[model samples]
Target: MKTEAQFENADVNMARRSFLHYAGAGMAALSVLSAASCKKDHSKPQMTTGIDIGATGDLAILNYAYALEQLEAAFYINVAAHMYTGASDDEIALLTDIRDHEVAHREFFKAALGTHAIQALTPNFSSINFSSRASVLGAAKAFEDTGVSAYNGAGYLLKSADYLLLAGKIVSVEARHASYIRDLISPSSFADSTVIDSNGMDKPQSIAQVLAIANGYLTTKVSAINYGYKAY
Candidate 1:
């Protein structure tokens, strides 16, 4: 016959063994789950060769703008570093201001996007001769005109009222830049019939149209397909 104390000891030992068994099983299950999760993560697709700006959402629009700003900022930075010869004092001052504005716009978008901002793009200005006044101003005019048209076309796509307001402000400034550059290229051509319609409305281009022109000057090809915008 077993003593009472011995019986109690046997019960305690069985209980301890059972607890350890369940604990070990739980740990093994957790390990299996962790492994499965990691495998799923690894199997996910990565960003492809071209820059995918992403589809659907306010973020996509923001990223689109961010990419353009990056391009403009890079161009202005390069031009400011080595200004064209025979540039007037007024031209230099205007270009400097434009550079600062573009830099500020780039930084603003980056800060707003935080972790979602696209990578800095590499601009191909090989076609532009920075030493020549005509080439430099011509390039600037193209960029500003494109920027304004881009904003105008994309403004309706924004979901947030605040974002629309902010875009309006920026586009107005872009228009100013475009006007200044246009006047520099040809006297009194700022609001000419070429850029504005007979009704006096600024012309707008779709994302595809804008990106097609922009890609010619950018090493990184921007793809708006992910954002549901048609590819050029």
Candidate 2:
């Protein structure tokens, strides 16, 4: 028969294991709760300074992408809220879907970047006549095309393979948005020579090039001085 001391030691070990198992589970639950809280909390400190997407590194690239996503999300949200005159039911549904996707993209980067994420940007759409279908779709085309090119151009700058993979996934979605917008404006022009070269490859715009175009629609500016981009 086992001694009483041995029995007690066995009982202590079993109790310790049980405690650890529950503790591990608790930590996992806490992690999920923390992520949810981060996503739900939208009130971030207001920033008055222009956005410097960092000098160089994965964080800079991620921030650059984040800034673009923020602009696109804001634009799409407004478009959905005050849908253009003559917008078909199908058009509203599709535009709303685009808005949701952009919001998800924005939130994903915000969560992934955590403490390093840039503050929300304020977009200026005074030039866009939201009530007109031509104006709304035209702006959408510009935003979507710029987003696709921005991702393509910046993909090579990411040092992390994981980040690169994520960029590729996002750019593909942006491409789809670009194509859809193109078709809406002009049927069968989705993959025209403008986006697809004779070699059948999509064109990519450098950070400087993209920011120059994007800044036209934003009150805040985005810059990548560290990436040898200046005068934007």
Candidate 3:
């Protein structure tokens, strides 16, 4: 049988391989977005106290996703910097992989958005107790769940089929992250009925709903006013 340390190393290796595969796919997809964007207006959104994700069609949705990715990335970066007490080697490896993935997702959106990308927002993790395992995993579960829902809800708002395709790809990854985090919280609870409905589908949340929950963790609020979404 493989030793615990061997398992940890294996998991970390797998995660790095996955990240490389994802990065290659992401770059290909971004190239498509770049070429497609050239034909359209590439104006930047107006800046305000809080980040305005713009009222424009696809760009608005992209910025919206970017904002959420930024929050998740920051949260995990903090978690990895100081892991909770008593965290096992397996947990550390898994969480580190998650952090790398979230960071990749964040940069992907930023690059895809290019000039239209929203500025990076400061994260507010004051409510989280990173020193406790329960607190850290609980917060991770919430972020992953919210991210999956946000992508599902906003996919339809994208005007370009290419953009929608990209969103679909990203959301699928987010769902995997959600499942992993959920299982970490409670074994075999990854697809609980609370998030998975009677129809056996993952739940989706509106941009307004997502931002309302997300902004609480962000020092800089985000708005998709053009989509008529005002964070509550």
What does candidate 3's lDDT look like per residue over 165-221, in tens digits? 767888898899899888888899999998998999989999999999998998888
Question: lDDT: which candidate is best?
Answer: 3
C-alpha TM-score for every candidate: 0.79, 0.78, 0.82
Report the lDDT tens digits of candidate 2 across residue range 1-232: 4443453354334434444332333234434544554566444333334777765367678889989998987887778778899999999899878876776677666656667677888889999998999999999999998899899888998766667777887789899999999999999999998888888999999998999999998898877775457518
Which candidate do you rate higher for TM-score, 2 or 3? 3
Candidate 2 lDDT at 44 equals 39
At residue 185, candidate 3 shows an lDDT of 82
Q: Each candidate: RMSD to true structure?
A: 22.4, 16.4, 5.7
How many clashes in candidate 2?
0
Model 2 misses residue 2 by how many Å?
Answer: 72
In model 1, the worst 10-residue window by lDDT is 21-30
For each candidate in the order shown, give its overall lDDT on alpha carbons. Answer: 0.76, 0.77, 0.80
| Candidate 3 lDDT (Cα, 0 to 1) | 0.80
TM-score of 1: 0.79
Please give the distance, in angstroms, between residue 94's alpha carbon in candidate 1 and its true position after superposition. 1.0
Higher-ranked by lDDT: 1 or 3: 3
Off by over 4 Å in 3: 1-49
